[model samples]
Target: MSQVVLITGASSGIGKSIAEFLVTKGFTVYGTSRNPKQQEVNGVHFLALDVTKPETIATAMEQVLEKEARVDVLINNAGKGITGPLEEIPEEELRSIFETNYFGPLRVIKAVLPTMRKQGSGLIINVTSIAGYMGLPYRSAYSATKGALGLTTEALRMELKEFNIKLTNVAPGDFATNIAAGRYHAPLKQDSPYAANYGKSLALMDEHVDHGEDPQKMGEAVFAIINEKEPAVHYKVGAYMQKISVFLKGVLPSKVYERLLLNHYKL
Candidate 1:
């Protein structure tokens, strides 16, 4: 039997690409959106799932299990983007992003573990970001959320290994997606102290996303990971430079790396 795969945030962008690609590979794919307009999309079933909502997560899981009996793979891809000076971003917004990006995935994982444990084999992929590897100017909250998720996955992987279940983190760099349109931006206050630098950083982030790699590449990378018999706990998909930045951080002195980031962002 073909594996049953479930992906969150699959209405568009990277999630959509992954869902469509997996369908071609003969997996019974279920893609989810907060508001699904159709029951099927490009050979993938559409389910309504809001990661922040536990009831919706449970409902979606139940729907999938009722039809497929088991979900062989779970992709935690539903996440929101937030960018602003940490000092100026509202506390509520920070909490909201954490709910969507960090706690949301954890909630879904908890819901699925019982089913996977019964099956005795399964894989969970948490979609993180290259930004998670380091702090970025004006994107601190976004970085923190991903970083937290990544670290949690590291711990969970060991805990789940005994059950023959696998967990991994896939950190993608900026992709040409609609993420920018959905990202929350603190107002560019005319009198705010961070106006100038924050504005520059925000514009640069948008520019990167506008010209970033195709989402299909991410889809392909994920497909390969699913096929692997023994996958690593952490996988990074991005341009050479973006991947190298993480390596550089490890080798370079802390202050030097900080200066490099400052120069790159033109701060």
Candidate 2:
């Protein structure tokens, strides 16, 4: 029997790519979206799911369980981005971003735990970003959510060790996706001091995204991990510079690393 895999945020981009790629390899893939009706792919079963909505997440998972009997892998790929200077961003807006990016995944993970615990083995992969490690100018809220998810994943790995449920956190560098366009940009006041720098930083950020690796590569990385008997706890998906930066983050001095980070954006 094929391993049953369920992925959230399957409507498009990396999520859709992963769903398609895995199904082609003979895995039973259930790809979810907020509106599954219009997000159909060739080989994925469309399930309506809005990660932020508890009822919808429960319903989607139930629909999958009824057919598949077991979900061997669960990939939490659904996320949204928010960008702005920390000072200008409202607390409420930041909370909403966390709702979608961090808490959203946590809810789904919690929902799946009971089922996975019963089965005695499972794999969980939460998609995060490089920004999780470094605070990006004009993208502080986005960074916070991802950073929170990263640490959550780390904790889950330790907690689930004895259960035979493997947890992996993937920190992907910019990929060619509509995430940038979908991201919320703070409504800057006409005379705000951040106006000029915001524009420059936003442009630089977009440049990294526009020039990021193809989303299909991310699917390949997922495939490699799924086939593993015991995958590593963390993965970095991007070009050499991006992956190397994850390494340099650990060995470089705190001040030196901070310098490289600021220099990357010419801050």
Candidate 3:
């Protein structure tokens, strides 16, 4: 029997690519979106899901389980980007970003755990960004959200070990995706305090993303992770420089690493 895979935010970009690729690999794939009514892909099934809402999530999980009976793989790929000076970000907007980026995936995991435990095995893949490891200059909130998820995922991995369920964090450096399209920008003008620096940092971020790795490549990386009997807790998928930056952040002195990051962003 083929494994049943459930991927969130699969209507477009990396999520869509992963769902479509897995379908070709013989997994029964169920892809979710806030509005999946027209998210029809040749080999992927669409399910309506709004990760921000508890009711929508519960309803969507029910719909999937009701149809598939068992879901073996769950990929939490739904996220939005928020970029700007942390000082300028509204409190509510920061909270909202956390709602979708950090807590959203956890809610879905909670809904699926009972069934996964009963089944004796399951796999969870949380898609996080490399910026989470080394904070980005103008994207502090976005970085914070991903960092929170990464830490939470680590704890969950340890807790779920004896239960036969496995979880891993897939940290992508920069992937050509629609993530930048939905980015939240801080309100600022030429005379505003943070405008100049924020604009420069934001522009560099945009350039980095525009030249980032391919979204389709993530499908192969994730596919390999799923097939591993014992996968690492953290996996980095991006350009060699980006991956090296993450490594150097751990090895270099705090001030040295800070200087390096600032220089990279031309700050």
The residue pairs found clashing in candidate 1 are none
lDDT of 3: 0.89
In order, how many clashes per candidate? 0, 0, 0
Candidate 3: misplaced stretches above 4 Å? none
How do the residues 36-139 of candidate 3 rate in per-residue lDDT, one tens digit apiece? 76746878988888889999889888888888888799999999899888887899999999999989999999988887988899999999988899777888
lDDT tens digits by residue: candidate 1, 1-267: 999999999999899999999999999999999999999978999999998889999999999999989989999999999988889999999999999999999999999999999999999999999999999989999999999999999999999999999999999998999999999999999799998998888889999999999999989999999999998989999788999999999999999999999999999
How far residue 88's Cα lies from its native spot in candidate 3, in Å, is 0.8
The list of candidate 2 runs beyond 4 A from truth reads 38-40, 188-190
> Order of all candidates by lDDT, from best down to worst?
1, 3, 2
Which candidate should be chosen as best, given TM-score against the real structure?
1
Candidate 1 Cα outliers beyond 4 Å, as residue runs? none
Worst 10 residues of 2 by lDDT: 35-44
Cα deviation at 213, candidate 3, in Å, is 1.2
